[model samples]
Target: MIHLTLIIVDFLTGLLAAGAWALASAGGAIAALVGSGFVGFSLFRKWRRRQ
Candidate 1:
């Protein structure tokens, strides 16, 4: 019984870690996309001003 409990706990811990990792990865990708968009807009404004 103890062995089964330990296995269940280990599996739950692993699932939580994987979920956290996936969320972090998605957040990072979103941040990168937003940053790129901001930079692109800034560059476009500067180019427009010059013309």
Candidate 2:
């Protein structure tokens, strides 16, 4: 019984850790996308102004 409990606890902890890592990675990806979009828009505006 004790061994079973230990395995279950380990599995749950691993699952929680993986979920946290995935969330952090997704957040970073979204931030990068947003930053790139803003940069692209600014460049386009500057190009248009020169033209």
Candidate 3:
């Protein structure tokens, strides 16, 4: 019975770890996208100003 409990706990820990990793990855991707968008917009504005 103890062994079964340990197994279940391990499985749940692993699942939670995986979920956290996925969330971090998604957050990072979104951050990168927003950063790039801001950079692009700034560059576009500078280019238009020169013209």
Candidate with best TM-score:
3
Residue-by-residue lDDT tens digits, candidate 2, 1-51: 999999999999999999999999999999999999999999999999999
Model 1, residue 35: displacement in angstroms?
0.4
How close to the true structure is residue 23 of candidate 3, measured as C-alpha lDDT? 100
Models ranked on TM-score? 3, 1, 2
Model 1 clash pairs are: none
Residue clash pairs of candidate 2: none
Candidate 1 C-alpha lDDT tens digits along 1-48: 999999999999999999999999999999999999999999999999
Off by over 4 Å in 3: none
How many backbone overlaps does candidate 3 show? 0
The whole-model C-alpha lDDT of candidate 3 against the native structure comes to 1.00
Off by over 4 Å in 2: none
Model 3 alpha-carbon miss at residue 2, Å: 0.4
Query: All predictions: root-mean-square deviation over Cα?
Result: 0.5, 0.9, 0.4
